[model samples]
Target: MGMMKRLTAALAVATVLGGGLVAANAQEVVLRSADTHPDGYPTVEAVKFMSDVLKKETDGRISIQVFDSHQLGEEKETIEQTKFGVIDLNRVNFAPMNGIVPATIVPCMPYIFTSKENMRSVMDGPIGEDILKAFEPAGYVGLAVYDSGARSFYNSKHPIKTLEDLKGLKFRVIQSDLFVDMVNALGANATPMAYGEVYSGLQTGLIDGAENNWPSYESSKHFEVAKYYSLDQHSQCPEVLMMSKVSWDKLSPEDQTAVRDAAKQSVTKMRELWDAQEEKSRKIVEAAGVEINEVDPAPFVKAMDPIYEKYADTPELKDLVKRIRDTQK
Candidate 1:
């Protein structure tokens, strides 16, 4: 009888342990992550960082499945899907988000940030927080910002060494009034088009030039078609990683903490990657026969001053710009 009682106790303990293991396994959550960049880009690296950290920190309770090269869809479609709760997360350029949250356009205005450090200070500080807050009403929870280096001009026709050089050139631009106005102020015909079509458009001579960072110009091989890369560095539009409000609301407080912590880590890592990648990209483009010109930015800055004036009527935007200019150190 004593032997039988001991066997029964051991069986009960084993059953409880097995049940606990099963319960823990059942708590797993799978998330979907989407971005427009191709697999080998630095943007994809940042997404992977978030995925790896989240899985490890959650002890495998959560995992992110990443979609690169716009496998899910374009920026607009991805954002719409996120808003409708069909997707969990997406990394978007601020230009597209401006459509959903108009206030986001404020940051993309020409010359809003005079230097990379100034831009970093604004985005990593309270001003960026305020911009993030503007997205909540549109069903997004902004997590972190990824650097999309400063925007500059590239053309097949001529090197834009001065504002006059840009005159009458057809320049491709994103569908943002801020971009349009800035390009217009420089005397170029701003042609708004989707990014995927830029290479072909430039190749076929449908457009004379476009503006983007060094990495994008190199990676997309736009340097092959457009020979001149003028470093105007007119605007610094950082991409944002955002979560679906529907998905975020479902997370327990502990899981929310894990996600936020992972996002912060990814942002810091991305900045380091961006700085390194920008240098690498410049070398690559130069090797590919792209002539890089470092023009005096003062003329460009002076030409874009009207953009600031256009927004000056609004106290919030004016004050925000003042604060950013003051915060430079």
Candidate 2:
């Protein structure tokens, strides 16, 4: 009878050990993330933060690998790959995705945001949530929004101090209807082009000017050719961190929670990096012999009023603009 009891006890111990081994094997997960920006940019910093947190939180069971500097592909291409489940995550500008998700274009409208603080408030609240929800149909899960900074004009021709100064200038703009329309309304010819082509376009004088935030302007060395830096702050364009719905839905509940938590933390870090870089960018461009001018934005604001009115008439987009304006402080 004692011999029989020993056999039973050994069987129970083996069962427990097997179950523990199965649980350990189930915890491992790997995810991939992509971005178009070069290393050392704010977006990369944020992605790195996410990668570090996910690994630490899951005790090495979850890991994220980031592809930077367009190593995977351009923003739009990367986002499309994410949708098709080829890539797990990407940081993309809202412009290209606007076609798939219409409301994404609203924030790119000129003069929509009065200040950086106002932009942050609206994006962190209901308006931001609504925009994020619009991504579901496109097979993307919008995780967080990172600052792209306020876009302004840069040209090699001449300084754009007044509305008339922009007349007939061929300015390269991203492929967005709102951006194209806004540039047209200001009396400049808007030539839609890819971000990678802008530097060479300016160098060859194929395009007389382009518009972007200070960090981009300085980092891409557009200031080298475009000696005129006009701080019109026309649009506050924020970059979005998104994940493939396929990959997101595949995560265990615990892993999903961890990913969300890491995303939130990364956004806070990205904003701090962006703010510091914007200030540093301004000094760098000024020292590079790039003429930095703070012009009156009233003219640009007045020019885009009609664009706002048109969007306001649309049922879905109307309330968001009102909410943003009301929340402005």
Candidate 3:
């Protein structure tokens, strides 16, 4: 009888241990993502979509928690954090990465992309793949790219019908030398500032104007302060989704593929959201009585020639620039 009791106890203990092992194997992983845009912004929503895709693809074992509205940090700060693995994922404009990642410089060049479709074609093709590969050496795994509609200048001062209208206006630019030079070349005072500070800068008269997409202008409510928006469509730089190499290296090979696939699928969702948001934001700003104008892009394009020469200093950048321009859109 005692021998029978010992066998039963051993069986019960083995069952409990087996259950614990299964539970350990099924542990959930939630990656933390950061974005400077506010919650429900197209990019933020897209990341949420990515999370859904990841969760479903991984059978609920993997997911993402996004912190938007500078919750983690601004673009520049988040870039560094993501590199160090303090942030698992990041969505940032190409401008901040230009100085650190040479591949990004050409893409951020003024007038480099002729239109949204042109930009999308170049980035969705081989050229874009090359740029994504470049991120690895910079401690990031390039996940996907999203649209940042054509950026144009808007000011609290007056209409910018000509280059003359932009002169002497203190404009807020991302913390990038290219942006500074671009604004200065157009004869405006370029004040390099964080994205979060632009609204307050406009309201307090600290900056005479700033430049961005319609969605940004409306979402940030900058349209209320800077009523004059000129559609020169200066830069069509795309936003990038990135994963920290530190976090990526910790994932299994299968999970890595799942994450990459999920991010890629999220791009389609992002573009759809982006198109609708752009139109919605445009209507919202127009309804708010913001004076919008369309300036001849000839002078604006001409002013960027020197800028192009200055940034495409290396053979690689020049080659990339030529290929992008020559690419059939």
For every candidate structure, what is the RMSD over all alpha carbons to the true structure, in angstroms?
11.5, 11.6, 10.7
Q: In model 3, what lDDT does residue 305 have? A: 87
Ranking according to lDDT, highest score first = 3, 2, 1
lDDT of 3 by residue, 81-156 (tens): 6776667899998878887789988888898887898899889899999999999999999989898899999999
TM-score between model 1 and native: 0.85
Candidate 1 lDDT by residue in tens digits, 178-220: 7788899888899999988999999999999999988888888
Question: Scored by Cα lDDT, where does model 3 land?
Answer: 0.86
TM-score of 3: 0.84
lDDT of each: 0.81, 0.81, 0.86
Candidate 2 lDDT over residue span 1-329, tens digit each:
24334334433542564411122366676676778787888899898988889889988887777778877666656665677566778898877776788778778778889889888888888889889878878898888888889999999999999999999899999887778888999999999999999999999999999999888899899999999988899999777888888778877788889987898789889998989999898899889899888889888889888878865457777776777778864
Ranked candidates (TM-score, high to low): 2, 1, 3
Error of 2 at 221 (Å): 2.5
Q: In terms of lDDT, which candidate is stronger, 2 or 3?
A: 3
What's the CA error at residue 314 for candidate 3, in Å? 0.7
